[model samples]
Target: MVVMWMVTGGAGYIGAHVVQAFLDEGMAVVVLDDLSSGHAEFVPEGVPLVRGSILDTPLVEAALREHGVDGVVHLAGFKYAGVSVQRPLHTYAQNVTGTAHLLEAMDAAGVRRIVFSSSAAVYGTPDVDLVTERTPTAPESPYGESKLIGEWLLRDAARATADDDAPLRHTSLRYFNVVGSGRPDLYDSSPHNLFPLVIEALLAGRTPRINGTDYPTPDGTCVRDYVHVADLARSHVVAARALEAGTSLEPVYNLGSGDGVSVREIMTTMADVTGIAFEPDVAPRRPGDPARIVASGELAARDLDWRMRHSLTEMARSAWEARRQA
Candidate 1:
C-alpha cells in the first residue's frame, strides 16, 4: 500500500531528515514550508513542494486532498524558547493557532493519522534527572506552554474523531535537543540551536560562550539530552507504521537519549571532532534556562519499539562534518 505523507516545515533541520527517512522507506512526501527558517536547498528533489504557511487552511486542505495524503507529519511552529519568552503572543499565534488550523484542515480533508512534533519543553525544568513520559507538565516559557497546548489539541482532536464516522488518528512525539545532520546538503544555517551556534563559533575562530558556570551540575553548567536527528527521524517513521498497524496506543511520547550530558561536554566533543583547541568563554546563565532536563524513551520503546541509536560523539561529528561541508 502506497501512503502519501504531508510534511509541514519539511525543509528545516529535523523535517528534512524525516522527509529523507520517509522517502528511503518507499513512501511519497509533499512538503509544505514557507522558507522562513527553513532553506530551499534542504528539500530533496521529486517531492512535491508547497510554499505557504500551516495556518493557511485553504492551501493545506487543498494539498491534503490533491496529494491523497493519508498521514501528516506536523513540524511547523516557532521553536526558540528564549524568544518565545520575550514574545509570548507570537509563539501562541504560530504554535497554537497554526496547530488549530492544521487540525481543522486535516478534518476537512478527511485525512487521518498525524504524527506531530512536540517538545521536551512541555516538561520544562523537571524535578528529577531522567524525566519519564509520565512526568507532570509544568512549562515555564511560552514555547513550552505552546507545545503543551499543541499536545492537548491533538488529544482532543483524536478523541473527537475516534468514532468510525470521524477522521483523525494522531501521535505527538515530545523531544529534546535534536542534533546532527542526515545529509551534508541538508544542514541548518545560522541556527538558534546550541550545537549549531557552538560549531559556528569554532569555525569562525572565536571562543564559544558558555551560559553559566554556577549550576548545580558537576561542570557548573546545565545538562541536557541531545538526540540525533536521524534517530528522531526514524522514530517518526516507526510512529507512522505503528499507527497504520494499530500498534501505537498513546497520543503522546517523550523521545530522547535517556542520558544527560553537560554543556562543557559538548564543547569538548566539538574540539575533539574538529581538532581545534578552542577555549570557551563562561557567561552568565541565560534567563529561564533549565538546570538539567533529561528524558526517558522507555515508553516510546515499549509502544513504538523505538530506541536511541546515536552517541554524543557521533552527533557532534555529523554536525561538524556538515559545518565543514557548508
Candidate 2:
C-alpha cells in the first residue's frame, strides 16, 4: 500500500516545502492547516487541504481516518519567539495544547508514526560553540518551552505505547534558522524571521536594521546556523521513511549547518543577492537575544541524509527572488 502522510501546517513556508518534497519522492500527502499563518494557495492542486485547526480533535481524527494517514509531520504551531514572550498563553494554547490535541487524534486514528517540527529555540542561549543533541535545554521563550514540551509528549507517548502491537514511533527535527524557498510560489511571509525582515525592508527602500552589533562574535553581531528550506524539507521525508520502515531514529535530531553566519554577513549577502547597496542600521540587542547558536547536524546527516545543499548566497538569492515574485 502507498503510504499517506498528513502535514500539519502544510501550507506554511517550511511545511509547504516539506509537502513539495514528499511529492517529489512520489509520496501521497494531505495538508491540515487552519490558514492562520499558512497560505492556502501554497498547498498544491490535487492535495486535500483540510482547513481546520489541529486543536479540533474530532476534525483531525476524522481527517486522519478518512485519508488513511500513516504518518504525520507536525509543524502547526505559534512560531514567533519574541511575540511568544508577550503572548505566553496564546503560544501555549497553539503549540502545547495543539500538539497534545494532535497526539490525541493520532492515537484515536491509529496513526503510529510522526515527525515533529521542533526548534533550536529549545536550546535557548547555549554557551557551547557547537550545539549538539547533548546540549542542555533551557528554553527562554514560551515558544521554545512549548516545543520542548511537545517533544516530551512524543517521548512519553512512545514510552506508554512501547509494548503495543504498533508503538508510536517518532523523531523531532530541531530547526536552526530555516530560510530561503524551495519554490517561487512558496516564500517565508513571517514578519519576525530575518530573511523576510531584511527582504521586506529592502523592497520598501528602507535600510534593514540589525538587532545587535555588540555581540561577542567575530563581527560583533549575533551568529546563527542558516539552512535552506528545501534541504530542511527533504530531511522530513527521510525521517518519515525511516519511521515507516520501522528504523530506529534518535528521539531528536538537530537540522543545522554546523557553522555560524553573522547578521552583518547576511546583510552583505542580501545586498549582493538583491543588487541593493546600503548598510544596515545597528540597533540595540533585542532582550534575551543570544550572541550565538550554531549546531552540528551530524546525527541528522548520518541518519536523515541532512546536509547543507545550498550556499549562503543561494539562500539569500532564492529568498529574495521568491519574495519578489510574491
Candidate 3:
C-alpha cells in the first residue's frame, strides 16, 4: 500500500525539509501552505502545493481527501516567541485555533496519524540543566502556550476518536534552535533566526550584533541546542513510518543535542564560514531570554534513531553556502 502525507507549511524552511524527507522515504506528499512565511519555490518539484492555510477548514479537508492523505505533518503556525508576546491573539489564532481546525478536518477526512512540529519553548525556563520529557511545561510566551495547547488537542483528539475508528496515533517533536540547510535552495528565511540574521548582515557587509554579553553562561551569551534540519526531518520520517506500521511511540520526543552550542561559538563559526572578521556589537539582553536550555534526546534516539549528525562547523558551512545561493 502506498502512503501519502499532507504537510501543512510545506513551503517553509522546516516544512520543506520534512517534505523532502517524506519523499526520501518513498512516500507521496501534498503541501498546504498559505505562503505567509513560506516561499513556493522551497517546495520540491513533484509534490503538489496547495496554497491555503489550515484555518481554512474546507480547503484543508479538500487537500486531505484529494491527496488521499494517510497522515499529516503539522508545521504551520506562528513561531516567533518574542513577537508572539505582542501578538497574542494572532499567535493563538494560528497555533491554537488553526490546530483546532486541522483536527476537525482530519476527523472529517478520517486521516488519523500526525507528526506535530512542536517546540522547546513549551519548557519556558527549565529548572534543570538538561531538559527531559518530564520537564514541566510553563510557557512564558503566547507562542509556547499555543504549542502546549496544540499537544493537548492532539492527545484529546486521539483519545476521543480511538474507540470509534482506528486509533489516532500522534507524536510531537520538540527541539530548540533548528539550524543548517539540507538543501541550498531551501534555506531558512526567517528574519529572526540566528544564522539567517548573521548571514544577512555578512552578505550586506554589516556587522551583526549579539543580543546579550552579560548572561550567566561561560561566554556571557545564551546557549541553545542547534540541530541540523536534515537530521530533524529524518526523525519526523521515522516517526511517521513507525505510526504507519502500527508501532507504539511516545506521545512526545525531544530531538536535541545533549550538550548545547553557545551564541559566541555560533558567531565564531559564522565568521569562519563566511570569511568575515569583525567583533559583534554587544547589546543588552532581551527580556525573558534564558541563559541556557538544552534537551536530552535519549528517548527519541532509542526509538526513532535521532542523533546530531552534523558538527557545528558543518552546520555553519551549509547555512552559509545556502545563504549565498539564495
TM-score of every candidate relative to the true structure: 0.97, 0.99, 0.98
lDDT of 2 by residue, 122-235 (tens): 999898999999999999888889999999999999999999999999999998689998898889999989999999999999999999888889999989999999999999
The ten-residue window of minimal lDDT in model 2 covers 282-291
Ranking by TM-score: 2, 3, 1
Measured over all alpha carbons after superposition, the RMSD of each candidate to the real structure, in angstroms, is 1.2, 0.8, 0.9
At residue 133, candidate 3 shows an lDDT of 90
The C-alpha stretches of model 2 lying farther than 4 A from their native spots are: none
Error of 1 at 156 (Å): 1.0
TM-score of candidate 2 against the unseen true structure: 0.99
Task: Put the candidates in lDDT order, highest first.
Answer: 2, 3, 1
Which parts of model 3 have CA positions greater than 4 angstroms off? none
Candidate 1 to native Cα RMSD, angstroms:
1.2
lDDT values for all models? 0.87, 0.95, 0.91
